[model samples]
Target chain A: MYNKIGPIFKKEFSSYFNSSIAYVFIVLFIFIPNLMFFYFFGGIFKEEMATMRRFFQMMPYVFIIFIPGLTMGSWAKEKNEGTIEMLFTFPISQWKVIAGKFFAAWALVGIAVGSTLFIPILTQLTMGDFDWGQIFTQYVGAMLMAATYIAITFFMSSLTMELIDSFLLSSSILLLLTLCGYITSAYVMIFPDWLGWLKVILNEISLSTHFNNFSKGVIHTKDVVYYLGLAMLFFYFNMKSLESRKWS
Target chain B: MISVKNLVKSYGHGKPAVKGVTFTIGKGEIVGLLGPNGAGKSTIMKIITGFLNPSEGEVLVDGLNTIDNPIEIKSKIGYLPEKSPMYQDMIVYEYLKFISEIRGISNEKADDAIQSMIKLVALEKVASKRISELSNGYKKRVGLASAMIHDPEILILDEPTAGLDPNQIIMFRKILRKLSEKKTIILSTHVLSEIEAMCEKVIIINNGEKVADNSIQELMKTYDKEQFIDFVVEGESLLSIEDEISQIKGAWKIEFEKKEGKNQFRFKALISEGSDFEKNLKSNSNNWKLVSSEIKKANLEEIFLKLTSQGEDNV
Candidate 1:
């Protein structure tokens, strides 16, 4: 076993913690979702039977904002700082470098997402109405949704050497992917024929479309395939862009 | 052993950065790649390191083509890029350790490699400090140390001493000199003296082409063979010797200046049979003694300028 991915993985993972912004990410990521669950969407105590539905509802919005911040620096900073020169010259394959950075960012986001485990457990402890299966699916859905976001941002980061440009481009795309599921239905009712095909396409492409069922206490094979497939597609796109950078 | 043949690299549709530049470096030979800014020196190094693909032609490292077998070629090379861009947050010692691991050196050997690199580049004092905290010179040493940690047989270092102080440059050259016995080195620099001191072979490139390729001794002897001869003669004034100086057949661009008590005259020489400028001067200036004369051959700095400036005019 070459274990080529281990050193890059270890270094990339520790680098996230080395900076103070990682703390900022965790605090805001955990705090904002809980805050919205408690205060903005009607308090947990205000409902007849409270659950983490609102928390799950806001997870996509939070990820659309934070995951770009995590991945914006992955390829963009390396390209800008010219570390890509040294890294690309190494004997290792380019995809492994992308994988190492992806796993590091995804795992860090996982920790921030994992801390929300206390959310479901607290609901179970305080109330007798929560479903363990729903909570599990929601956690699994959140993690998978994050994989797609991370993959998309990694692709965007590889397209440019400037960090700000990568952040802006990925952020705009992530926002569209998440919000399209909610907006496409309304647009279809107004314009039936042209907007009809959009519904079919967005159903397969939308981050919210697949995630909608998971939040409603159900998991399907199509949704799992949708997330993993999208994630893999974008990662492949990233590898292609890196190939162009080197070979072209 | 490395061989580059007819390498052509172009960005988009623009002019090729390297245009049919070909050279071969033998085993254990330290070759300096000298060029002006944007002269395709870095492009050649990048191609050799397997970081960039040549649009046409090929580079062979130990008989393996670069495009076909980049991984095997890369494994034998240790590269220090132009900027020496280390991860800013990584500690000096940690960076070397990372390189060792990626290079597939085991833990025990990696520790030994790290310690030796620290001592080699004199990075022991700041080994634990963050890379961003180190100064430019120290960062360069760290880059050099990291590149050599794998103990690769071929080294491709780009501007390795760009930011080092005088003392550090000497120390850097000393390290390279010691390593030259075992490693094949190809480095690029604008500082011609660095090449004169370190490399026996120098390749001067200009405008994406090889302008001159020869050793120091061969270059001095063959390149720009015309020499300048200076003669100090006892003379009252230029009027007395003007007629005799003009009759010199084998030289031109003659100029005279009065210094102390004698007149010193210099001319470019391309000596021919039976038409000697010194003989002419001596035959006419028998009235005034020829005090002393010296012939000055062109140095590396002059030859570099002559080669590259000529390149500047053509394209």
Candidate 2:
């Protein structure tokens, strides 16, 4: 399994660099947030900031576009080119291919996320008194959040034949999943009394509600499990989609 | 080495693509799957390669069921899909290496296998180029190389020469002929001449049914009972010659074509069973110049249409 997954991961990982999109995605991911933090939220990064809190705080939301953009073609493009047939016919299992692509997309997203480490590194030098632990936890939270989005969209890529459709569907679903958490987390109850149970369930299931723990420098086992569990479940869905052709 | 038993597949709507088709292929035999477009040739090949499962039947490769032992069967068979879609972003060498790795070739042997495949497919010149940059013919060669990189005992190619030019098709056939010496090959094509050129056995499918499966020579003789009195004649107007040829008993015209602005005409007539049409044609009219005349058996093309068209008499 490792032998098969290892080569697929390597090929898939490099496939990102094979096109200009990886560079484009990395540039945009690093710039938009940092650009906004310094330009729009300048006050937050000033003396009020002991950690790079504002920058990492909004990453999960920003990933709604970038993550889907990278993964919309993971399976969709293969289907368009008819390469998926050859890929699936190999002596490997479907799970390994999905896992390989998962890690590849996850690793590419990691690089996009990792490239922004210069932000915290340079900011820590200038501030001279920064909570490195908070920054680390924030990075971890952002990555975990990105992993969930990648898995979900990777599965979305397999559901559709067109790249545009995959991107639209993935972003819409990610937007909904991420937004439900934000809406449910407010202190005042936003829904009617009868619908209060829905808000509770949405909060429990919302991605940001779970991500809120890590962004706040708290690495709870529950939040970690939530992100990891959601990622695996979606990965399984992607495998199921690949195997659907065989389903009578 | 491969057996398909009562294969049936449906896309979950309308009619089943393949219906109860059964055939077995021997080891090292080059079999051509002959069918028109949308005739379920690719569907059956997919089931045998383990890319898709049969809805009602089972495919066995060397006694191992495709559903139960897919990986083992897939490893034994090398498949090239229709139109040869590839990862255009990858270089030819990188693509082959990746396929070799997926084929479970060890790191130590992978390089040698890649080199040999490049040489075999004549892809050395464009080995470093991206697949998208290559022409259709070269891209097909790359697809063939990637399929055969592992050197499996069985090779399944779906319309391998679908888009190639005449020169490339000839070259591709040469490579396939070489491979057939040691491997069992099942290649599907609508072009009947390709089967005549490369395969010893032909399996013809029509409308989700196996119409005929036989040796090329057997298919020609068994299904093609219509005998043709093929002849070429030269005459002016030929109005007199036509009326005379039409008067002959036990003979009906099958095809006729007159060369443009010329006195030459080529025609074939299907003679009735055991009739003396050849002698009657000689006695009927001697006005036209008889450039050539011969009574011949129907070729593979005529036999294929007769079998696949289901007695519609496409001729």
DockQ for all models, in order? 0.59, 0.65
Over 4 Å off in model 2, which ranges? A186-189, B228-296
Looking at model 2 chain A, which ten-residue stretch has the lowest summed lDDT?
A43-52
Interface RMSD of the candidates, in order:
0.9, 1.1
Candidate with the greatest lDDT versus the true structure? 2
Tens-digit lDDT string for candidate 2 (A106-175): 8988888889888777877776677888878988998888889999999999998899999999999998
Worst 10 residues of 1 chain B by lDDT: B266-275
Worst 10 residues of 1 chain A by lDDT: A43-52
Report the number of the highest-TM-score candidate.
2
